[model samples]
Target: MDKAARKAILRELREQERARWWATLGLTSAQLDALHEHILANLIDCCSGELELSEQWANQVGVDWSRLEQALMELGGYCDCEVEANVCPD
Candidate 1:
């Protein structure tokens, strides 16, 4: 209803959404990195930040694409929804 109340609601929603991202999956960055590296290692010689890893390789290496996608989406949500806008214009 008021400014303070709206801010409090936003903060609470942000926290809950963030928790679902990192905590619900129960995965650390290191673990996710390992999965990526494993896929990259077997499917790619060197990523160089430009490699299209195959789905077969992903299946073979057991990469958790859904979780990674979810994490990335959540990070985007944090940046877009929680961060102040236009602090530094491009």
Candidate 2:
């Protein structure tokens, strides 16, 4: 597919995901960024390797962990590998 097509596809997917998130709970962009950082640093691999994910390479930013987890679960819990039933998703 062409670049424009790929961008459209990605944008559509994000819209769908955002809608799904809104349906579950109201969220703010900062909340999303917090959870994203947490997941990258903890759950995802950050090593320099062929399989390493670029998202995890950024510097850690301060975040309120509990609040961020709550927001992420509400917004993108299904996308998470597995969340502890008792604990909120990241």
Give the top-scoring candidate (TM-score): 1
lDDT on C-alpha atoms for all candidate structures: 0.46, 0.46
Runs in model 2 deviating more than 4 A are 26-90
TM-score, every prediction: 0.34, 0.32
For model 1, give the 10-residue run with minimal summed lDDT.
77-86
lDDT of 1 by residue, 6-40 (tens): 99999999988756755744556465455445444
Once all C-alphas are superposed, what RMSD does model 2 give against the true structure?
10.5
Instruction: Tell me which residue pairs clash in candidate 2.
Output: none
- Give all candidate RMSDs, comma-separated: 9.6, 10.5
Clashes of 1: 0
Where model 1 places Cα greater than 4 Å from the true spot, the runs are: 28-90
Instruction: Report the Cα lDDT for residue 66, model 2.
Output: 49
